[model samples]
Target: MARKKTDQKGDRLESIRDAHNAEKMARTTRMEDYLEVIYELIQHKGYATTVDISNYLNVSSPSVTKMLQRLSESGHVNYEKYRGITLTEAGVAVAKNMHDRHGVLAEFLMMIGVDEDTANRDAEGIEHHLHPETLKKLEEFVKLAKNQGLFR
Candidate 1:
């Protein structure tokens, strides 16, 4: 039937959309992890190295190198072999957004009685998947809770 065919077409479209979203999310999460590590390392040490990134990410050195190459190609970083790594302007923007989001999420979880370590770990797990609107609302909630003296 034409109706049955239409329904199947709709289902196929929805499946495609879901697959696209999943791939986007995976890329975003991976990129966020790398950017956050680079940002944090640079903050602490004024530089980031492949070995440091590998250690922080718990990934192999070759894996970090490969990803860094891709990031460089994408204009997200300035990377040279055996030299320090630095984020490009676009990379800094993404890294700063991610940093703010991570801080708010971890602070919220801590206010809810989660330990610092656990809150940070959990924030990293879910940060890239959060909708911007949801993160905004959560940020406001954390602020309100702070104003109310709701947690230590």
Candidate 2:
């Protein structure tokens, strides 16, 4: 009986670990943060540089260099010295997804009367934490509110 109890507990622990791993995979990783910022900068301004990214993110150039190297190795970005960086296909997809999440959350926050700057700042943090289902609902609600001419 004790053997069976131990086995059951082990199984439960494994299941919990698996759930945590899945959740971790579902959300963005820290590296993704850099990629997302580059993606946004590229989209808005047509190019991104190490200095601009460093300034916007408030990180050192050395730190950004380390991450850019990792991202390049992971096939998420193409980095070169004295030249701008660009995202690969996989990187673009991830960046676009992150951007969409930020857009939806920011719009939702603004719809509820949050100021533009605060909403954007809050959305940047909230986007990483929101689950897919919750983000979907928030997007839908924001769309509906916009249709109703609410919060204009």
Best model per lDDT: 1
lDDT for model 2, please: 0.86
lDDT string, candidate 2, 18-68, tens digits:
867876765346676898989989989999999988998899999899889
Q: Which digits, one per residue and each the tens of the lDDT, describe model 1 over residues 83-112?
A: 879999998988998999999999999998
Clashes in candidate 2: how many?
A: 0
lDDT of each: 0.89, 0.86
TM-score of 2: 0.78
TM-scores of the candidates are 0.83, 0.78
Worst 10 residues of 1 by lDDT: 19-28
